[model samples]
Target chain A: MIGEMILRNVFHRPVRTAISVIAVGVEVMLVILVVGLTSGLLHETAKRVEGVGADLMLQPPSASVFMAFSGAPMPIKIREKLEEMKYVRAVAPVLLQFNASGGLDIVYGIEQETFKAVSGGFVFHEGGELSAPNDILVDDWYAKAKQVKVGQTLRMLDNDFHVAGIVEHGKGARLFVPIQTLQELSGARDKASVFFIKLTRPEHTAAVADELRKVFPRYEIRPLKDFLSLMTSSNLPGLETFINSMIALAVSIGFLVIFLSMYTIIIERTREIGVLKSLGASKGFIVRALLSETAVICGIGIVLGIGMTFGMRAVLTRVFPTLTILVTVDWVLRATLIAVVGGLVGASYPAWLASRKDPIEALSYE
Target chain B: MQNAATILAPAIEGFLPGEWDVDLILKTDNLWKVYRSGKLEVSALRGVNFEVLPGEFVAVMGPSGCGKSSLLYVIGGLAQATRGHVLVDGNDMMALSDAARTKLRRHKVGFVFQRFNLLPTLDAYGNIAIAQHIHGNGFDPHRFEVVTSMLKLTDRLHHKPSELSGGEQQRVAIARAIINEPKILLADEPTGNLDTKNSEIVLGMLRQLNRDLGQTIVMITHNPEAAAYAGRVVHMRDGVIVDGVPED
Candidate 1:
């Protein structure tokens, strides 16, 4: 009976109820989108790094393990010394550059023969692989987003290059060019950003890393697994804070909207509360009723939020193909839990106030 | 003074003593209620002793500001007396905690207000069933049928309060107050908002319920016609009982 009463009361003022529901839905949507995008970026980064098919990685002493932001370039001669060591099957040097389009595109420069030797060769979706110094290979997603086709001219870093081919999704950088040409364009000739070293046997990974560490004492030599772990860890500055702030903002918006809505409801129903008390309703009963109403609203909001998330993902994938959004069950559950908790917390004060009203005064209220 | 047969039978009384026998279901001894706002004190009830025996239909009559409503609220355990003793169903209200007092009200007392305070969102049946729900027992279909039939609300059960007439609404309120089978029914001007015809209808229903079910009732009203339905009427003036004097 109490539950039915609460449900009816929630619909007593339809406009106000709709507004509150929408507020919660919008907040839940924002939380899922922001968190989902971040997770997708991390997942894609890990996959791309693992696709290199290397057992060990070598970087300059001062360079960060995160390839996207690492700026310190190593001497290209380091690849020859690593290839000569025991248990080293092959070595490929890679030059990394941020494109002139506001750093949205990562440009990787690779020597065709050594890159194919150390890592598996790329699978082209449109045309043949890179053959000329000015030829570039783009990923499918980037190609769709940039609207560039094979045999078309593309511009990056204020230089024109011919589009040679389109790589399979999640294979490599969005834009790829010849190593010597990129080195000249970046003004760091014979300097590579990192080296990918393939081991002869799977068991030699740790020993090979130890050997390379001694060979280049001042450099950072790590097994591929440790390097990937470092890339995914919280070593990225401001990322943790950014995610935390997004969560906080989402919670605050949900909490305040529910608080204001429930508070206004209490004020409007002061007389009704008195009537309930007169009918022998305990304070606990009133609080439970109010909370149950809020939970119902939040439940609806969460469902709507999840629906909107899938809808937005579908639309985003079609419009901006390069953007990835990962909506896993765990993330959905987390968003629901946060929204419900925020709504309950917001309603607590109003429930308390309604429960504490004097029955006589409330009865007499106009 | 009239004997029990004259008073408890169908005879009318202008005044009665404030004391009763040990069979009392409700009693208040020297109950005092003081309202303070910024150092100004207003005493609503001043040393008022009252009692109602089991199955008695008693009426408390007073002018405005004579503490009739305050005394009813205190006896119903809805408000705390400033300094006094209130006993309902043989339990001392002052000795009980706030929560216990609430429990006492939930299980032992039912209230009907002058305004017919039915929940606007609920229909007549829902309003009546809520009292039983609050008492922790799901609705008793048998008792619901009995109460609705007795109050003549069988046909109007599904109508909301706004859709019902004033008298029908009050009947629903009466049905709600009695559905839980509380030990006592405390009504504050149950017919205060009705016309003469509806007032007579409601008063007749109250009288029939008392006579048929042996229900104990304490009603506060200013209209003598409303008080006439009770077996005895106690009149108050200036926060003190003026018409009723108990025999030692």
Candidate 2:
């Protein structure tokens, strides 16, 4: 009977109920989208890096694993010394330049033969790779997103480069240029940003990585296979704080919305509460009714928020094809739990007030 | 003083000493309810003594500010007396805690209000059933139907209060009040918000419940015509009963 009364009361004020539900939904959606976008970007970037088929990455001392943040600081001559190591098949000394022309992208500068040996080589859809100083190979996703053609002239980094080919994506970057051109353009002549080392056998990865780590103890020598697992918000500086701040913002929105909604509803229903008390409703019963009403609203809001999140993911990916949004079950459940707890906590004070209201006074409330 | 209730308490002149250990269902001894505002104290019930036998239908009549409603509230356990005792069916209402008073209201006392205070969100049936549920017991479908049938509200059971006529809403309130079969039903101007025609219908239902179900009732009213329906009338002036003897 109390359940029925609660549901009926919730439905009694449609506009108020909808406003509360949508507020909570927006809160959940915000938290979910923030977490999803960050996790998706990190996971996608890590997967792309692993797709290079490198057994190890050798960077300059104290260089970050985030390729875009690392600069072309290592000497290109170090590739030969790395190539001299046991079980090392090839070492691709690549220059990385951050480009913000039409969009954000990492421009990879590579020597064709060694890069091909390290990555199994690009699977071309049209044209050919790295045949000229200004020939640029574009991946399919970037090609489609930017509408680049095989014979088109593409300008990046204030330099005009003819499109050499459009290849399959998932090779660490969307655009590739000759190593010497990027090194000269960036004024870091004969210096590579990082080294991608191919091994003769897959099992030799640990042994070679251990050997490299000991030789250059200060350098960031990382096995490519283990890189993705280490790429998380906790492993990245400031990322965890960014996510926590977003969650706090969402929780605050939920709390304030539920608080105002429940407070107003209780005041509006003061006489109704008095009627319930006159009917012998206990304080616990009134408290339970108010909190249950909040829980129901939050539950509906959570489902709506999850649906809205998926809809947004689709719209975002469609608008920006390069963008990836991964909606994980873990985060969805966490957001739902957070919204429920926030709503219940927000309603607690109003529930207590309702319970403590004098029945005669409440009955006489206008 | 003819009986122990009077002999044991000859202080109450109105009682004239009732018979024996008191077959009375309700008794208030020197009840006093004072409303204090800052440095002033205005008394609503001043040394009022009252008694009601089981199955009695009594109407309390008074002018405005005569403390009729306040007396009903105190006797119904909705409020506490300033300094006195209210015993309902041998249980001391003034001595019970807030929770115990609430429990008493749930199981022993039921109330009908002037405004027909049914929850607008619930239907007539829901309003009536909720009381039984609040009594912390299982629902009795037979009693529910019987109460509705007694009030001629069977057809209007599914209607919300807004959809029901004024008389129908009052009938629903009465059904809810007696749905749990409480020991006493306190009606505070139950028809004060109704039209003359609706008032007659609601008053008729109350009399029928009192006569047919033998339900003990204490009703507060100002209209002499409304009080005429009760078996006995107790008139009050300035918070004290001016006429205690039954003139019916």
Candidate 3:
């Protein structure tokens, strides 16, 4: 019966209820989408890195696990030394340059045979591998994104290169060129950013990484199998704080909306509160009824927000195919918890006011 | 007749030690209710002594602002008296905490207002059933059927207040007041908004509730015809009862 009254009161003022619900929905959507975008990109990027068929990645001294952020400080001869290591089967030296022409992307400069040895070669969709000094290989997603064709000239890093081939995605980077060609183009003549080492067997990755770490303790030696686990917002600098700030902002939106809605309800229903008190309702009962009403509103908002999240995800991913927005179960639960708690807290003061209203005065309230 | 336990429990728990008065259902001693705004003092009730015996239906009649409503509120524990003692079912309302007073109101007192005071959002059944719910008493189907049937509202239980006539809304309010079996029913002009016929019908029901069920009642009103429904009338003038409760 109390539940029925709550529902009635919720719908009694439709416009206010809708505005509050939409506000809460927007808060939940914001929290979910903000957390989803960053985590999805990081996880997807890590998966693509692990998909490169390398068992171990060796970077320059004090280099970041994110090889894109690390410069080409290591000499290209480090690949030869890594190739001669115990249990090392193949090594590919890659020079990376950050490209910002159309969008943010890492350009990989690689030697054809050694890159093929480490990555099991690309599945070309249009043309073959890089052969000329100005030739470049683009992946299917990147080709579709930038509208690149097989024989068209693509200008990047202030250098025009022939579009040699279009390969399947999920290799390390979208755009691939010869290492020595990119080395000259970027003014780092004998430099490579990182080495991708393919071990002789799967189980020898830990031992090989440990041995390499001892030889060069300052260098970053990361096993590819553990890359996905390390790709979290907390592992990256300032990213977790950014996500928390967004969540706090979302919570504030939910709080203020719920506060105003419940306060308005209290004022609008002042006479009704008197009736409730005259009916012998305790303060706890009144508080519970108001809070329960807020919970129902928040519940509807959360469902709508989650639906909007998936709807927006579909629209966004379709329009931007290369962009990945993942809505995980963990983030969805966290958003729900956050919205509900925020809404309850926002309604507390109003509930207290309602419970404390003088019965005679409230009955006499116009 | 009330159940044996209902009759016996109040005897045991409804009084401070050695202060029990079994003959009186409600009583007030020098009830003074003063409403002060800054330095301007307005006395709503001043040294007014009133009493109601068990199973008595008493009416408090006065013009507007004469403190009849203030007396009702004071006795029902709905407001604190500036200086007075209100005893309901042998329990002093002045000394109890807010929670205790609320509990007393829940179990021992019920109220009906001039405007019906029915929650507009709820239907007749919900309005009636809510009283038991608020009193923390479990639903009693037999009592519900009996009361709704007595009011001739068994079929109209699903109608909202807007759908019901003025008399029907008042009947629903009356049903809500009695469903919890409160020790006393306090009403402030239960028929003020009704037409002549509806007022007659509602007053008839209140008399029926008092005569047939032996329910104690204290009704506040200005109309002499409305006060005539009660077995006795107590007239108030200028915050004091000019003519007190009549001899049974």
Candidate 4:
């Protein structure tokens, strides 16, 4: 019966079936997009934090914010004190200053070789590392925007530096410069600000951050994970509220759409349902058949939506090198569950209405 | 008439006489159905007393709105009669819950509708096969051959309802109705949708089902020609059974 309901009746009416498919598809797309974008944003921001490769952020006792806001910068002495701690694995210091060509941006500076381990791909796109004290390694996006390439000279801080290598980082905006070069050029007050520390283990991160904060009572110390959330939330307004509202809106709208579409289908198939009822089909049979159709359409929509997400991710990352969309298993599970619930919830009204129809009246219905 | 009634009454009540044809197959006594449309009480069946024995062929003839169909419905356990009792195969329909009525409908009664109401999605074979599947019984290949051939549906078994003629679809509907070998066959205007030629063909198959398989058939139709095919004809008007006549 499932096979017959799924393949024969569902596939027979290509138009209705297509409409069902589209309904399911839209539901799936909405769920996947919501989960994908939110999760992707979270992942991408976290990746950026990890790109700084910091276990904990140690800042100026009074002036430093634990989270890296757009303008606030830690002083150099804080880094010196943090490095002096025995638990600190290694300390890589960075100075950040803003540059705005179109929107807000950040220019980061760190020691050439240590910056390699700290910033990872923040220097050269390929093989070579950040070597010259006066040379800069910017993100590929910024390089293209500024049209600065290797051997080309760019000016900042009232000084010029060779474009060393276009690099990539998980956090912050686009620029990477040598620590000595940025200090001389940007004249950033007390240039050395951030200390990116690779922690000994998971248990040591909070302890180390707490110990660092105690020593620098004026500054806030935070684990990189917490710092990343702070950075992302500060950039977006009412982050939790916005996400909750969007999710609530999607779910409500999804239920309404699914309900109406499925209801219309049931109304259209009233005669067919009557025929089934008259044919000794139990109510359970009809219910199962309707649910089976809903499940199939929902499944189709989920697959299509997920596929679209991956496809869009490919295009997005290609077009905007800075936009990294990450899809995780949790996102897939969440999207699929939403699709199913939407389908089932959507199917509820129609199934009940169909079942409530009197077999004789439905048969007589033209 | 006496001979037909004698033959049919036994089939209607089987060998047992005292239990009101409960196990005999389809039975109803003092069944009253009142249709209330916002305080307008229209009595469709006023204490309809009726019975059809196993393998008996009966026809109901009546004018429009006479409630012949309602009688069939109440007996088939489709509609709940407002008062009195309905029993099929010795089971009290009114006393039993809705679920039990449905079970009786599934296992004991097979219905053929006026519209030749075959499920459009299923082909002729599928329509017949679905009954067997629903009953949790294996599809008998020999039974399939027998019924389809009897209905002259062998050539059309694979065709969908749209592809079949009205008569052919009705025949498939009949095939579906009897595919379960139900105790009682209730057909509502089985020939109403067919042309004369097709009507006769449907009537012919039904007659054969009655004669050979002893399948009890209660058909509701206004056509005199259709009524003539039945071994017994019951005339209905305003929900009352006016006459129970056995046709020779």
Native contacts recovered, each model: 0.77, 0.73, 0.79, 0.44
- What is the TM-score of each predicted model, taking all chains together? 0.93, 0.94, 0.95, 0.83
- In candidate 4, which residue ranges exceed 4 Å CA deviation? A52-56, A59-66, A70-73, A83-105, A109-137, A141-165, A168-173, A177-188, A191-193, A197-213, A217-254, B1-18, B22-24, B245-248
Candidate 2 per-residue lDDT over residues A225-303, each given as its tens digit: 9989877988778999999999999999999999999999999999989988888788998999999999999998998
The candidate scoring highest on DockQ is 3
DockQ each candidate and list the results: 0.70, 0.70, 0.77, 0.49
lDDT of 4 by residue, B1-248 (tens): 22212222223221222344333566677889999999799999987777666778889999999998888888887788899887676667786566666667878889998888777888899988887777657678888898988888999988999999999899999999988888889999988878899999899999999999999999999999999999988988888888884333
Provide i-RMS per model in Å. Answer: 0.8, 0.8, 0.7, 1.6
Per-residue lDDT tens digits for candidate 3, residues B1-248, read 23112233254354343264457788788999999899999999998888888898999999999998899898888998899788888778888888878888889998989999889899999999888888786788999998998888998999999999999999999999999888999999998899999999999999999999999999998889999999999899999999965444
- All candidates' lDDT scores? 0.85, 0.89, 0.89, 0.73
Please give the lDDT score for candidate 2. 0.89
Candidate 1 deviant stretches above 4 angstroms: A100-103, A225-233, B1-21, B245-248
TM-score of chain A of each: 0.94, 0.97, 0.96, 0.73
- Lowest lDDT block of 10, candidate 4 chain B: B1-10
Give candidate 2's chain B TM-score.
0.91
User: How do the residues A1-366 of candidate 4 rate in per-residue lDDT, one tens digit apiece?
Assistant: 447745676677677666666656565566566556665665665666566766776554443332234345656666576667867766777886665544446677776555555444354574255666776677777666556677778776556767777765554446677777677666665656666776666579878877776777666566776755554433455665775666566566656766776787788788888877776677777777787877877777677777777877788777666565657787578767877887788887688788777887888788
lDDT of 3 by residue, A128-231 (tens): 97889999999998898778999999888999999999999999988999998889988998898988999899899999999998988889899999989988
Q: What DockQ number belongs to candidate 1?
A: 0.70
Q: Report how far off residue A247 is in candidate 4 (Å).
A: 4.4
Stretches of model 3 off by over 4 angstroms after superposition: B1-18, B246-248
Number of clashes in model 4?
10
